[model samples]
Target: MFGGSDIKIDVKKPVYELIVEHILTNYNFLHKQVSHHVDVEYSAVLTGLALGDGRIHSAFKRARISDENAGEIAKKLMDTNIVRLLKSRKQFTSWVDDERVSDKLLFTTPFMRFWFAFVAPIFKGIKEGNYDEFNQRYENKIAEFREAVFKELSNELVKISFAEEKVVETGAYWDREVELDIFAKTASKKVIVGTCRYTNSKLKKSEIAKLEELANRAKIKADVFVIVAKRGFSSELKSLKSEDIRLFTLKSFKSLL
Candidate 1:
């Protein structure tokens, strides 16, 4: 899609191979330099794990590569703009005071995460042109795959919802104590927090409770709350009769565009 033809998907090439080609095209460091390395296969394994797990330790373990090799692969990925680290949103809290926090690793885009999470791991089948097997595997796990994309959309909605205010911050919040799926603040200092449920069942009031709990543990009060749901809200949640809350379905999110 980059130039409409050269980088776009077609029926001829399998999706797994397409993503590999895309990465190989963009990351010249990975393409030109890493490919020349004696441990190229090892590097590719680490790259796939990094994209799939979003954890450095898990990536190393999955690849069964030494820490030294994993570190080199990570440096290449970072240098080539394929992946980046996300620092934990929890700061200046009880947990912050007690222990050191680690950053979460994230892909630069939704497609990269999707490709790595499901496609890249089973590359042999893809190379063998086993489209049926890849399709079945992808179909079975796509709902889980889209959660990351949905979370990204939910973050976008927070900014859209607060258009009147100067949004100072917006991102996921996590500490040893709790994790707020959507967190933000306005220039007026309004605290907004939320969560997303990308399942068939309706979102419930307990979700709000969870956000409140996370806020309490992190010692912050929210001036507004939002919910992004795929199915919709429960009757109890819809009838909550509260003014501080806003709800968004997948359909409603389109309007924000």
Candidate 2:
């Protein structure tokens, strides 16, 4: 439906406006569900809860709300698609005692993440036309912000690698002890887990050991170990590497793009 008849598009303003509109719309919906007044405690609590890489308990503490209230609101927020709750992979969770709530809640998109993080917080400044404050609060944690993109890219890479096997689970894995950035399973029940490093530095050999250590702590016997780095790997990791170690640089990701 979004086609054009040789129409030239003024891309910049439209993109920003569209994103802003979405942010405002979701904010309004959330506001309505929580309270009649738009700028109230509920929205404030939500902003505190959503705009971080933390669990429900952490968010609740950040928002200064009770666990009961936080769980209720988190459920509502998750139900409304403003955010989503991803449980730690069952492989790791099954070993834990009683399988306590080990789910991570995050915004559905980076835009929503940014919106709740920056825009929603400083909306008053924007309403008052104070661009200075808005600009000041714009914290672009590039690696943190780009995590969702990296996760999806890794998922695609897994599908490519397991084209022959029935790729079962392809997502992240985390427990109290460790967090595997990308965790997947094949039809033959083969486990594949890895991490993503989007930085200027080269991937170090220590990373391989760290992944192995974490997997060991979690009692996961990963068949394939993958590393997706922005820069290339270190010479130490390159030489005398085990066949299980697989590497992918930023250039490697371009194939999927």
Candidate 3:
């Protein structure tokens, strides 16, 4: 919707074109909503956040800036409500002590993330009325992009699903040796480890085994396992859902609605 009224959808227009016309091209529209403090340094940092997988260290590296500069910029961004940091989950053991793990820097809103990832990176060509570059890059990784967003949403859904458990803390978890899409703890100190798969096919029983293996490697004694998928689950996997396991599909998100 634009200007407090619904804009008619053009069925034949490409989604990107629609986005550019309705959002990107309208300078005044964005000027009214987004921060006006964006400078070259801020743009670079945003590009880094978009491409660096939200890792502070990686963002600095990807943006070709020093850690000190990036750290300063990140704090300012946080203060301005542009981005926020998610601290790395602390672990008791030192199984992968040699490897370094950094806290993640996330955009406060999806719109900012989308802008940096797709538009800002290729703004020169876009300004010249050439969208080939943007279209090519977007098409290649659109599924992966959507899945990343879905994983974040799944975190909220998981929190909502376990009403009795009362999740105390939840977020993405990564160690030198292992990574999980969903790593949460309940008020009762029960660990919940899970995965989110956005794919065309049904999630199989093997996916459960993989999550368990990762939890084992991470030394987490998971009391409940979760699987959120786009295309739902296989019949075999569906039949296995019990107190210990939970399965959720796109339709499961209706609960959030």
| Candidate 1 wrong stretches, greater than 4 Å | 1-6, 9-53, 64-73, 92-95, 241-243
What TM-score quantifies how close candidate 2 is to the native fold? Answer: 0.77
Clashing pairs for predicted structure model 2, backbone only? none
Candidate 2, run of 10 with poorest lDDT: 1-10
**Candidate 3: tens digits of C-alpha lDDT, residues 1-257:** 13222345585888777777866566345544554746555777787786556888877787687876776877888887767888655453324466667878887776677767777777778666677888897888667667768988999998999999899889888876788889888889888889999999998989999999998988777889999999999899999999999999999999988
Off by over 4 Å in 2: 1-42, 91-94, 240-243
Kindly report which residue stretches of model 3 are placed more than 4 angstroms away from their true locations once superposed: 1-14, 27-35, 91-100
Task: Give the range of the ten consecutive residues with the poorest summed lDDT in model 3.
Answer: 1-10
- Whole-model Cα lDDT of every candidate shown, in order: 0.66, 0.66, 0.78
Backbone clash numbers for all candidates listed: 1, 0, 0
For each candidate in turn, the TM-score is 0.75, 0.77, 0.86
Model 3 residue 216 distance off true place after TM-score fit, in angstroms: 1.2
lDDT of 2 by residue, 1-257 (tens): 01111223455656445434444434545434434323355555556644555477777777788877877777777776656777778544336565465467766655445555666677766655555665555435434656656666777887676677778788888766677788888888788888887778887889988988988887888888988887788899777356577788777766676
lDDT of 1 by residue, 223-243 (tens): 888888999998888986364
RMSD over all Cα atoms, model 3: 3.6
TM-score of 1: 0.75
Global Cα lDDT for candidate 1: 0.66
TM-score ranking of the models: 3, 2, 1
lDDT of 3 at 256: 88
